[model samples]
Target chain A: MTSEAPTDLAIEVRGLVKRYRGGRGQDELSAVRGIDLGVRRGEVFGFLGPNGAGKTTTVRMLCTLLPITEGHATVAGVDVGRDPAEVRRRIGVALQEVGLDARQSGRELLELQCGLYRIADPAARSAELLRLVGLEDAADRLIGTYSGGMKRRLDLATALVHEPQVLFLDEPTTGLDPASRLTVWQEVRRINALGTTVFLTTQYLEEADQLCDRLAIIDDGTIVAQGTPDELKSELGSDVLTIGLDPVEHDRARDALLTLAGLDHVTDAAEGLAVYVDDAAGAVADVVRLLGDAGIRPGAIALSRPSLDDVFLASTGRRIEGGVPEMAS
Target chain B: MNETLLLARRAVREVWRIPAATIPALFIPVFFLVVNLGQVNRIFPPSTPFLHGQHYVAFQIPVSLVFAVSSATSGLAMVTDIDVGYLDKLLAAPIRRTAIVWGRLAADLARGIAVSMLVLAVGFAFGARVKSGLVGVLLLIALSAMWGVAYAGIAIAIALKTKNVQTTNASFIIFFPLLFLTPNFVPLDLLAGPLKAIARFNPVTYVITGLRDLVLFPDIHWGSLGACALTIALTGVALTALSLRALTRFSE
Candidate 1:
C-alpha cells in the first residue's frame, strides 16, 4: 500500500504518520497513525471525521504546515517530504480559520496575496477574485468589518489566486450559517468544474454526501472506511427500520427480531432500536409479529435507505454526529 | 525580494490604519520626557558644563527618541497573525519564510521613523536645538529608527518561540533595564562609580551618547557615531538571526 505511485492522483499518502515529541512529564503522542489515501484528480475528495479524529492533522501534513513523522505523501505529483516548496507552489490552502489580515481591505489583501504568488497584473487579478467571491462592492472595505461569510468567501478567493492545481479546504464552512454553507458548496462545485482537485476535510455528514465525489471516513486516527457515498451506503445492502421503544426494551426487541426473516442485525439507537434487514418491506410484518409474541408494543417506525450515518455506524459502530456507538445484539 | 516588499507594504498600511496601536506607545515616552524635564530643567541649565550651552530638553531628546521607538508593536502584530491564522496562510504560501520576518521589520523601520520625528518635534518645541545642524537631525532620526528596527527582532523572536500574546508582549519589559542602565540622565562622567561602570558596558549607552552628541556638539563626533552604528549593526544581526531561527523551527 505504501508503494503506490501518485503520478496521476491529486494527492497520495502511504503509511503516513505524525508524532508529537513529549515535553517534561508528558508522554509522546501520536496524532496520525499510519494511513493511506489517494485523491483522484479533478474531484472533490472529502476527508470526513469527527473532532480530534486527526482530520486537521492529516491536512496540515499534506499542506506542509506540519512535518510528517514517517511514511510518504505527495501532492501534485511531488513528494511532500522531498519537495514541500514545489508542492506548495502547486497547491492552495484555506485552513479552518479564515486566515485574513483584518487590518487590510479585501482588495488590498487579495492584491498582496496575488503579489506573493507572483501573479501578473495584481490589481486585475485581485478584482477578478473579488468578483468571483461576490465581494466586488466591498473590495475596499477593511476585512475586520466583513461578515463571517464574507471573510470565508474572501479566503476562498485568496486560495484561488494562483489557480492552483490542488486546493485544500479544511472545514471550509464549519462555522458558517446554512446559506453561507450552500454558497461555499456552489463555489466548490464551480472550482472543481474548472478542473482543480479539491481536498476538503469536514465533520458534516451532509457536506460530504453533497459535495464529495468520494470520501474516506476516519476514526481515532485511522481510516475505517472509504468509498463514494452511494457505494458505502449500498454496501450495507439493508434498509434501516428504526423502531421507537423504551431504552430498557431494546435488548428484548433485539432478541425477538433475531430469528425474523431477511434480518441482518439490530442495534440500540438513541430513540429506540435500529433493525437492519435485507428486505425492509418484507421484514416489517415479521418484526411486529415477533415483538408481539414477546408481548412488546412498538411505537412509531421509520423505514429508509441506509444513509452515510448508517454507513459510519456500520463501519465504526457509531454515528458521525452522535459520536457514540450503539450496542449491537 | 518582491514578496518581501509586498508584505512590507501591507504591514505599513496596517500601521497607518491602526493609529490606536501606535498612539499609546508614543504617549508613554512623550509623557516621561515632559515630566523629566519639569523636574530637572533648572538643575541642568544651558550654562551647566555638560549641558554644552543647551537646554535640558536637548539632552533628554535622544532618550525620548529611543524610548518612543522601541516598542513591541511588530511582535504584537505577529502574535495577532498567529492567533487569527494569517501566519499559517503565509507559511503555506510558496514564498521564502525569511521574507515574513523581513516584512515585519520593514514596517518597524517605518514606524520607528514616524515616532522619532514626533519626539524630535516635542524636543524642538521645548527649546532643544541640534548644534550639528540638518545632517545631525537627519542622522538622529535615522539612527533612532534603526535602533527600533534592531530591537524589534527580540519581540518577534519571542512571539514565534512562545506564540502567546502575553509572553510576546512581555519581551518589551526586558528593555526597561537596558534603557535605564545607559547614560540617559546625564553625561557618563557625572554618574556614580558603579553605575558608570555598568553603563560603560551597556550597548544602549553608546547609542544615546552618539545621538546626544549630535544635539550638543558643533560637528560630527565620528568616533562615537561609528561605535553607535556598530552597536546597532551587531544587535540587528544577532536578534534577526534569532527570529529567523525561530521561524525555521516554528512547525517543530
Candidate 2:
C-alpha cells in the first residue's frame, strides 16, 4: 500500500554465464552467455526474449534454483552461490509452469505455502492473498477445477503470501488467453505498486513495453539490447509509416517510397510497405503525392511510433517470435 | 528436526486429499493377508513345526507385514511432487533440501506402521498368536515398520532419478524377485536348489526369520534379530545417500 520507491538495489548480476550439457555426450549448451543485469528495489524490470533465449535460465540463477556455472550474481545483497538459502528466503518465484496441487483447494494450498515459509498467521495471510487475487469466492474449490487464468492468479497469490522483497515471474502469462493475460497484468501492476521489486520475463513484446520500467532483450543466451521501452524506441530516430497497397503495386510503392529524401529505409511486408522516415507527418504527404502521381494509390495508410517489436527486429534481424531456437526434446 | 517433522506432517495431510488412491493403498495388504491365509491354511499341514512349531497364519503374518511395509512406492509420491511442481517449490524454499526427503519418508513410515498394526490385528483375529505375548507383538510391529520405512528409500531414490510414474512403477520389479527369492514363501530349510543358496544371502530372509522367531517361537533369536537390525540400518544409509544424490541432480 505504500507509494515510496525503495532506495536500495534488490538484485545485481555481472557477466553471469550458465551452461548445460547439450547434444548427448557431455557437450556444453550455454543457455546464458555472460549477461549483465541489475534490478532496483520497487521497480518492475522485464527480461524480454523468445523461448530458450536464457530468460528463464537467468531467472533461475537469480532465484538460486540453478547453480551459476560462470560469472557472479547477488540477490538481496547475498551471493548466489555462497548464501543460496538466504537469497531464497528473501525472494518469491512463480515459474512459467503452474505447480499447483490439484487436490488442494486454493485456500488450502496457500495455507500450506504459508506453513512452508513459517509464517506466523498462515490462515489470515492465505485469506488476504486469496482476496488479493480475486479468488475469494473459489478459495475452497479444488485447484483442478480452476481455469488457466484463475490458476495463474492463484500462483501469483502464492508467491506473494510471504511478502518477499523480490518476486520473480518467468513468462507469467505465456499460455493464458488475452483476457486472462490482462487480468494477470493487472495483478502484476498491483504487486509492483506495493513496493515489491519485480523481475519479470515475458515473450509478449506489448506486455513488456507497457509494464516494464526498464527492459532487456536476450538472444542466443545473452542480452542483445537493454533500455527503457521508450528509450529503446527513441534510438530508431524516426516514426514508422506503413502503406497497404495492392500486391501488384508493391514494386512501384517501394520505388516511390525509397526515392523520397526524408525516408530512411523501406521494407516490404505482407500487408504492404513499411517505410521509416525522420518525420512521419512531413513524409506522409510527399509519399501519398508521389504514389498519386505514379497512379499507385495505396489501399490504406497508417503512421505510428516504433514499437518494441521494431526494436527487436532492428537488433536481432528477426522478430522475437521467429528467431527463437527450439530446445531438444 | 522441527522442519522435517513439519514437512512430514504436511505430507501426511496431502495423502488424505486423494481418497480414491488412499483407499486402494490401505486395502491391498489387508486383501493379501485374508486371501493368502485362507489358501495357506487349506494347503499346509496343521500345527507344523516348520520353524519352532509355528502355525501357518502366525508365520505368514510377519511376511504380510513386511510386504505391506515394502509395497508402498515413495517413488509414486516423488512423481506426484515432480508433476505438481511441489518438488521445485520445496527446493526453492528457505529450508534444508533434506527436509523434503525426510518429511516424505517420515510420513510413509507412519503410514507403513499404521498399516502393519492393522494387518497384525487382522492376523490376531484369524488365530495368529504371538508366543511372546503383547511385548513381543509390539517389538515385531516396530521392527517390521522400520524395515518398511527403510525400504522406501529405494523407492524415493528411483522416483527422484526417473521423475515419471511409469519408470518408478517399473522399479518395483526388483521387489517381486526379492520377495520370492528369499525364504518368504517357504521355510529357509525347505527352500531347495538356487533359491535356498540365495536365501542365505537375502537380507529379507533374516528379517522374516527374525520376525517369525519373535512372534511364533517362545524364545527370541537375538542373532537373527541383530542381523535384521543391521540390514535395516545399512539399507537406510545406502538408500538415503542414493535419494540425496538423485535430489541434487534433480535441481540441476
Candidate 3:
C-alpha cells in the first residue's frame, strides 16, 4: 500500500489491443483496437463509454482476467501478463456482474474472499466487512434472499475485504435505485479516501462526472477525450443552444441558424439544430427572432452549459445513450 | 490443502442448498435397484448358481450403489459455476488451480459415499449380506465412492470444455452406456462373449466385481479389487488431466 515508486501512477497502459478470433469461416471480432491510459495513485479514474465500446474488455485486460492480444499494461507496478498473481494480490475487482455464491451468506462470502487471499483473522475481517457494507442484519442469510441493492453492497464488500491497493469497479451501480446508487458512490469515495486507487467503468456520464476525479471519454474502443470534469467541460468553451424544429423544416432550419450573430457554429442534431454560442442568453433571443423572421415556428428551444454528455456529443457526434439526467452545475 | 477444503466446502454447500439437483442422481439408481430386485427374486432362487447361494439382492446391490453414487453430475455444478462467473471469482484469487479441481471432486466423493451407504442399507433390509462383514462393507463403500470421485473428473472435464448446461447434461446421459455395458445387469459369467470381452476391459466391471466380492464372494478377490483401484486411478488421471488442461487453456 506504499507509493514509494517514482511515478505516482497506480496504472499505466500503452497500445493495448485485443482481438477475438471467431469460429472457422467467421471474421475475427475486434473488441479493443488500441488504448493508452494513466491512472494516478489514490484517485478515482473513470472509464466511460457506451455499451459494447470495449470498456469491459479494457478492464479485464488490466485485471489480468483476460489475456492481452497485443501491447501491455502494469497495475500497481506489476506487469499484468508477466506477474498476474501479483496483480491479483494488489487489485480487487468487482466485475460488471454480481457473481456471488447464491448459497453463501454475506459473512460466508467475505470469509471465503479473505481466505482466498489468505488474510489473517478471516473471522474478524469478515465481520468488519459485513458491518461496513451495512449487511450485519442479513449477514447470515443466503445471498439469494437479499435484494438487488444488498447484493451489490455485498459484492463491494467482498472486493474490499483484502484492503487492495487498487480497486476496479465495473458498472457498480448499473441496476440500482437512486438511493442505492448514492450509497455505492459514497462507498467508492470512502475506498479512494483510504488511499486505494479506483478504476471505474460506466456508461452513465452523470455517474462518471459525479464520482470520478478525472475521466476518459471512450468511444469506438479508443479514448476520444480525457481530462478532469471541469477541464473537459471547458473544452467546449461555450453553451449549447438547441432549437427543435419540424423534421420537414430541418434543412431550412440548419441554413437559417448559420446567418445568426453571436453563434460559434451549428451542428444538425437528431431532433433539431444545435448552435454553439459564447453566451446562451444573447443567442436565445437571436435564435427565436431569426427563426420567427423566417416564418418558422420552433417546436422547442433550450440552452444548457457544457456537460460530459455535451463533451461526448462533441467527440462522438451523438449524445450518450445512458439516458442520464444531467443536473446543471 | 486447506484452500482445497475451503473450495470443496463451497461446492458441497452449493449442492446442499439446491438439494433438488441431486435427487435424480440419488433416486434413479434406487429405481433400478428396486426393479431388479423384484424381477431377479422371481428368476433366480437361492439354489440358482447365478447367485451362488448368495441373495440375488446382494448380487445386484453393487450395481445400484455404483449407479446411484456415480451419477457424474459434479461437473454439472461446475458448468453452472462457470456460467454464473463464480469460477472467475475463484480464479482471480491467488489459490492453486488444482485446489479448484480437487475441491469439486471431494463433494462428489461425499455424495458417492452417502448414496453408497443408502443402497447398502436397502440391500441389507432385503436379505443382501456382506459375507466378509464390516470391513467388506467399508471396502465396498470406499470402492463405490472412489469411482464417483473418478467419474467426477469426466463430468468436470466436459463442463470445462463446453461451459454449457445442455452439453453437460447430455454428457451425463451418455455415461449410462459406460455402466450398462459393464455387467450391471448380470455377472460376467452369464454375459455373452462380446459383452464379456468388453466387460473384461470395462473399468466399471472391475469396480462392480470388486465391490460384490467384498459382499458375496467367499474371500476378498484382491485381483479384482486391485484392478478396481487401478482402473479408477487410470480414469481419474486421464479425466483430471483433461480438466486441468482445459483450465490452463481457459480464457486464453
Candidate 4:
C-alpha cells in the first residue's frame, strides 16, 4: 500500500479493505479488514485462508474484479484502483471458478482469449498455449466435454495467452482428483519456472507449504500469519500434539493443558485441542495425565512436527478445517 | 470494436453449437403461425378487408416474425455465462465492459435475421406473398431482426440484474401480453373499443404494422415503416441503455 513500493515487487498492497453493503435492514459486512502484502517479482506467493476468510475478496480487489473499499494495491507496478487496465494487462487471472465456456472448444476459447488480448496471431498463440498446458489433444473438443483436469488446464492456458508478468490462480485444484491436483501443481511449478510471479490462494496447507515461496494465512477478514512455509512452521518452534475431545470440553481441555511443562500454547482444534510444545514425546504424557485428572477422556491423540495449520492455529486460536490436500476431493 | 466483435463471434458460435436454446424459441412461433392459420384462415379469408388483397397468412406473417425473433435466448445465454463464470473471464480481460453487452446484441442480430427468414419461409409455405416484393422481403427481415436486437435488451438487463436462469427465462413471458395487446387477430379499427385503444398505444403494433404493410401492399409504406423504425430505435436505446447499466453494475 506504500506509494514508494519497490519496483522489484510484482504486487504490493497496503491497508487493503473490502466491505459489502448489506441489503435492506441488514448491517454492512466487512469481508476483508486492512491487510498488507509484498509479493516479489518472480516467486510463487500464496494467499492462504479458509472459506469466507476474504482471500478471494482480496484477490478480486487486486485483480480489479471488485472495487477496493479502502486502501491501495499496485499490481505489476500499476495502482489497482487508479489504473486497473494496466494492471489487467500485466496480470492474468484464473479465478476459483474455472471461467471457461462450455460451448467453446479449448482451441476456440484460447483463440478468443488471444484476440481479446490483441495478440497478433491468435491461432499460433492458442496452439502454443495448448501445448504448454498439454491440452493439444483435447484442444478441439467442447469445453463441456472436457474432463475436470482438462478444463482446469485449458483455463490455465487461457490466462497464459498474453504471457502476463503475474498470474493469479485461486484454488486451482480445490475439486480436482489427487492425480489431477498433482498435475496442476506440476503445471504451476513449470509456469513459475518461466519467471512469472504466481499469486495463488488455497485452503490446502500442503499446497501452500509445497508450492508457495511465501504465504500469508488469512482468517475472518484478516491475515493472521505470513512467511515462508518453513519460516512460519519453524516459528511455531515446537511439535504439535492434537488431542481429540468433545467440543464442549475444549475449554476444560485447554485449562488442563495450560500448566503442562514446556507447553507453548493450546489452540482449539475442530475436534479438540491443538497443544504446541517443545517436546511432543515428553509432553504427551503430561497432556494425557492432565486431561485424565480433569475427569475428561481424550479421544485419538496424534503428535507431529509443526505445520502451516499449526501456524494458523497459533495465530488465530482455531485450526483450519480441511487444511490438508488429502481432504480436497 | 475488435473486442466486441471477438466476443460477438463467440456468442454467435454458441448460438449454433447449442441448438436446444434456439429450437424452442423457433418452434413456438411456427406452431402458433400454423395453428392460427389452420383455425382462422377460413374465418378471416383473403377477402377480409384487413387482408389488403393478400391472403390472411400474409397478414399474419409479421406476427410470427415478431414472435420468433423476440426471444429470451440472449438473456438466457447471459445468465448461463454468469452461472458458469465465463462472464468473469470476459470481465477480467482487458477489454471494454460495454463490449460484453454489445457482443450479446450482435449475436441477437444474427439470430434475429435467421429467425425472421424462417418465419418468412413458413409464411410463404402457407400461401402468403410479400406484395412489396424482394425489397419488402429484405425490409421485413431487417426490421424484424433489428426489433429482435432491440427487444433483447430487456432480457439481457434482466439476466444481468437477476443472474438467475428461471428469472431470466421468465422474461419471455413479459412479451406474451405485449404481443397480444397489438392487433394480431384483426385490424385495429375492428378490435373492441378497449382493446383497440390499448393496441393503438402498443409499440409492437407499429412493428407488426410496419412489417405487415410490406407484405400486403405493393409499395413501400414509408409512414408505417418510419413509425416501425422509430419504435425499434426508441425501444433499442432504452433497453440497450438499461442492459449496459446492468453490465456496469454487475461486478458490484
Candidate 5:
C-alpha cells in the first residue's frame, strides 16, 4: 500500500541496481537488484543486512560514492547519478571503513576537512566537533594513536562538520564493543535530533530495532521486508513461546507443539522449540501442560513478543545471523 | 580553488608531521650529490663551450637536482590514503574530481621544487653557478619540479589501479629505463651507439638537456625547454585522467 508523500523525504530510490564483475575467473554478480525505498527527513532509517548483503553498496550509491548501474535514486532532492556532486554537497557519510589520515592529528584533520567543505570559522568548528566526539582532550594527538572507537567517533564528527542534510552511516558500529556501540548510538540520535536525516546500515538487528524509526531488511541484494520494528513483528501474528526440553526430545516436542490450535508456526532453535501463535499467554501454558502430559519435561521456557529475529525467520525461514551465500542469484 | 588549496595544504602538512620520513625523503638526493661527485668527476672529460667551462661539480649539480626530482614518488602518499580510507572519503566529497587529482599533483610539484631548490642551494655552496642567472634558475627549478609532478601522476595512477604498495614500488622498473636511457651523466652529443639513439627519443633526455642548458650553458635553449614543458604538461594531464578513472572504478 502507498502512504502519503512525506514532505521531509530526504532520500528516495526506485528500482536501484548495482552489479560487479567478480574477480579471478568468477562470473559477474549483481549486488543490489531493483530495490525501492524512501527515507523521511529527521528520522533514523536503517538498512539492516548481513555481510555482503549489498548494504554498503546501497549506502555508497545514496552518498554518491558509487554510480548506479541502473534505475534511479535521489538524495536530498538531488539525483545521485545525474548530479552526484550536488548530492555529495548536501550529504555526509561515515563509511564502514574509517577514513582518518593517520599522519594528521585529530585537530589538524578536522580543520582540513572543514576547509574542504568551505566551512566558515573552521578552527571553532573543529574544536566544537572534537569536543562533541569526546576527543577534545586528545585533539592534538595523531590519529594513528587513536583506538578503533575513538577513530569512529572522530569519523562521525568529521561527517557532521559540514552540517549536511542527509548523513549516511554504513555499518557504523560493526567493530565496536557494546559500550562504544551505545556511544555511537547516542551520537547518531543527537545528529538526528539536529534535524538531519540519518540513513544507517547495520547487521545488528537489535540496534535497528532500538534506534531506527523504520528499517528495510535486505538479503542477497534485495529488500525482503520493510517496516517499523513493531509493524514487522506484528506481521508474524502474535507473540513467540520458546520451550526448551531436556534429553534432546526436539522431534517429539515439535510434533506436539504443531498440533496446538492457536499456534501458527513451529521451528527449532539451538536451545529449544520456538512456537509462534496468536496469543503467547494462552499458548505458553497449554504448550507446557501438553509437553508434561506427553512426558516431555521442559528445562527452561520463555514467552515474549515476536522480535525482529522472529520476523526475519518468519519471512526467510532462516536466522538473521545465519550465513547466506553472498550475491544470491 | 579553496578546495584544491585545502587538499594541497593537507598533503604538505602530512609530510611535515612525520619528520623521520620527511628528513630521509629530502636527505637521500643531497647525500647522493656529494658522494657521487667526488668519485664520478675524475672520468669526465674537460668542460666544453656548451658546458661554459664549468667544473664537473657545477655541471652535475643541475643533473642531480633533476635526478632527485624525478625520483620522488607520490605512491607512498597514495598508499597512505588507501590505508586510512581518505582516498574514498575524498571521492565521496562534493569537491571537483579534477581538483583532487590536480591538488595532489600540485603538492608533489611543490615538494619537488622545494627539494630541488634546497639541493641547488647546496650545490651553490660548492661553487656551482647559473649561467642564465636568476631567470634561468627559476626555469630550472620549474622544469625539475614539473618532471617530478608528471612522474608522480604516473605513480599515483599505478597506486590507485594496483592498490598494493609493493606492486607500485616494483613498477619503478619503468623509471630505471627512463633515467639511464637518457643523457643523465654525459652530454647527448657525447653519447654512443644505441644509447645515443635512445637518448634522442627519451623524454627525460629533453628535460635534462633543457636543465643543463639553463644551468651550464651561456645561452638559452628555448626549443628544448618548450618541448620538455609540453611533454610534462601532457603527461601530467594523461596520468591524472587515468588516476581519476581508477578512482571512479575503485569507488564503484
Candidate 6:
C-alpha cells in the first residue's frame, strides 16, 4: 500500500458500478451506475444524494467493505480490488449506523480497534482519542449507556485510531440534534485541516454546502453534477427572484416573466414563479412592470441569491428534500 | 495468533457483561441431571445389565453434560452483532478473518468447561462418584468442553450463513431431536433393532460412553476414550472448516 502514492488523487474511480439481482426471475437493480471520479488529496469531498442513491454502496466499495461488480477503484495509491487489505489499512470508515459494541466500554472498544490495527501503545492512543472526542469523562462507561451523539463521537474517534490517510464518513450526523450536528461538522473540518482527506456522504444539502470543500450531487446512482458549492450554484446563474401569484393566473404570470429582458430562466414554482436572471437588482423592476402590464399583481415578491437548492433543481430537475424550491412531489 | 486471542478475549468480556448469556445453558444441564436421576431411578429396571443397581447417576451425568455443552454452543451473540452493525464494523477493520469465528467458539468452549465443572459438582452432591480419581474429573471436563466447541459448529455455521438470530435459534431447536433419539436415556445393549443401529453411529453415543467410562470404571479405558476423542476431533475439524468457509464468504 505504501509502495507509491499515485499522483495527487486520494481516490480514483473509473466507471464504477454495483448491481443487485432480484429473486424469482425479476430484473436486476443497479444500485450504482458507471461513475468516474477523482478526489484529490487533503480536500473535504462530499457526495450528496437522496435515499437509495448508491452513496453508501460507493463508500463501501472504496472502504473495501463491498465487492465491485464492474469497475476499477484505487484508494491512497492502492488498487481496491487487487489489495483490499491494503486499502483497508490506509483508510478509516465510520459506517452510517454507528455500530458500536454495546458490551464494551468506550475505551475498551477503541483499544480493541487499535489492537486490530496493531497500533503501538494502544492504551496511550485510546486515552488521547477519548479526550479528542470529548468522551474522557465517559470513557469507562458502557457504550450501550451513551446517547446518540456520544456514540457518534466514539465512532469517529475509533475511525481515527489508526491514523488513516483517508477517512470516509457516511451521513455522520443524520439524526443528531442541531448542536450535535454542529459538533460533528467541526470534527470534519478539524480532521480535514489535519491533512486527512475526508470523503463524506450526506443527504442534507445544507450539511453538504456547509462542510464540503467540493461536492457531487448523485441521483439515480449517477453523478448529476460535481464542483465546489459556490461553483455549482453559480453555474445555474447569479440570483433568483421568486414571485408569488394567484393560483388562477399562474400561466399568465409565467409568460409575462419569461418576456422580461434580463431573465435567463423561468421555472414554475410551487406557489408562484422562480425566475433566474443575471442581475436580480436590475431585473426586479422589469419583472414588476411586465407582471403589472399583464394585470397579474403578485401577492408577494422576493429577490435573493440562488441557494444550492436552485443549483440542485437546475441539474436534477427535482429539489433536494425540504428545499425552498416548492416541495413538489 | 494474537489477533484470534484478542478477539476471543473481547468475546469473553461480552459474556462477562451479560451474565444471562450463560445462565440458561448452565441451568439446563443441572435441571436435567436432577430430573433424569430422580425419575429414572424410580423406573427400577433392575434386570438391565449396563447399570443393574449401580451408579446410574454417573451414566446420566454425561447425558446432562452433553446437553449443557451443546446448548452452550449457540452463536446468538454473533447474530446480534451482525444485526447491530458490529459485525460490519469488525469486517471493515484490518484483522485475520478467522479471528471472528475463533473468538466466538473459544468463548463457548470456556463457558462449556465452566458448566461441566458445575454439573460435576452437582452429580457428586447426588451421590455419583468417579472411580478414576481427580485426573479423570479434569479429563471429563476437558473432553466435554472439546465436544462443546465441536458441536457449536452447527450454530456457528448457521449464524455465519444466515446472520439472523432467530434462524440460529431455530437451528439449535431442530438439533434437540437428535439428542433424545440417541442412546441418551438407555444403554445400547438393552435396546434392539433400528434404534440400536442408529445409536451405534451417532457421535453422541461415543461422547456419552467416553464420559461414562471415566465415571463408573476403575481405570482409564484408552481404547474407548480414544474413540471419543477421535470423533470429537473429526467433528471439530469438519465444523471449523464449514464455519471458516462461511466466514470467508461473508460478503455474499
Interface RMSD of the predictions, in order shown? 1.2, 2.2, 1.6, 1.4, 1.6, 1.5
Off by over 4 Å in 1: A1-6
Per residue, candidate 4 scores C-alpha lDDT tens digits across A1-329 of: 32333499999999998999999999999999999999999999999988999999998899999999999899988888888887888889998999999998999999999999999999999999899888888889888999999999999998999999999999999999999999999999999999999999999988998899999999998988888999998987999788899988877778877788888777666577777789998888888899999999999999989988778867776667755222100
Q: What TM-score would every model get versus the actual structure?
A: 0.98, 0.92, 0.95, 0.92, 0.91, 0.95
Q: Give the TM-score between model 6's chain B and the true chain B.
A: 0.93
lDDT (10s digit) by residue, model 5, range B152-216? 76777778778888777664567768877887767788889899999888877877777777877
CA lDDT, every prediction? Answer: 0.92, 0.81, 0.84, 0.90, 0.80, 0.84
**Leading candidate by lDDT:** 1
DockQ order of candidates, best first?
1, 4, 6, 5, 3, 2
Please list all clashing residue pairs in model 5, or write none if there are none: none
lDDT per residue as tens, model 2, A1-329 = 22222336788888999988786677898999999988888889999988888998898899888989999888777787888888888888898888787767899889878888889998999999988899999999999999999999999988887899899999999889999999998988999998998999999999998899998999889788898999999997778888898978877777766678677677665477778788998888899889988898787789999888778877776677644321111
Candidate 5: residue B6 lDDT (0-100): 83
Every candidate's chain B TM-score: 0.98, 0.92, 0.95, 0.98, 0.90, 0.93
Clashing pairs in 3: none
Off by over 4 Å in 3: A1-6, A268-271, A322-329
After aligning candidate 5 to the native by TM-score, how far in Å is the CA of A277 from where it should be? 2.8
Model 4 has a clash total of: 2
Model 1 whole-model lDDT (C-alpha atoms): 0.92
Instruction: Please provide, for model 6 over B1-252, each residue's C-alpha lDDT reduced to its tens digit, 9 standing for 90 to 100.
Output: 377888889887886778787888778778887788778876745345676345667778888888888852457887878777788888888887888889888887888788899889888988778878998899999999998889887787889898877788775676576677677777777777888888888887888888888886779999879988998899899988888888788775
Q: Evaluated with DockQ, which candidate comes out highest?
A: 1
> For candidate 6, what is the TM-score?
0.95
Residue A81 deviation, candidate 1, in Å? 1.1
Q: State in Å the error of residue A77, model 1.
A: 0.5
Q: Per-residue lDDT for A1-329 in model 3, tens only? A: 43233567899989999999999999988889889999999999999999988999999899888999998788988888788888888888888888788878888888988888888889999998888889999999999899988999998988887899899999999999999999999999988999999999999888999999999988888899999998999988888887788878866776777777766667665577777888997888888888888888997788888788888877877678844323112
lDDT of 3 by residue, B84-200 (tens): 667887777777888889889889887878778888888889898998888898888888888888877877887888888787777567778878888776778889999899878
Local accuracy of candidate 4 as per-residue lDDT tens digits, B1-252: 299998999999988888888889999989998899889988987788888777788988999999999999999999989888889888899999999999999999999998899889888988999999999999999999999999999999999999988898887999999999999988888999999999999999999999889999999989999999999999999999999999999888
Selected candidate, larger TM-score, 3 vs 5: 3
Off by over 4 Å in 2: A1-8, A247-252, A292-295, A322-329, B22-40, B51-54
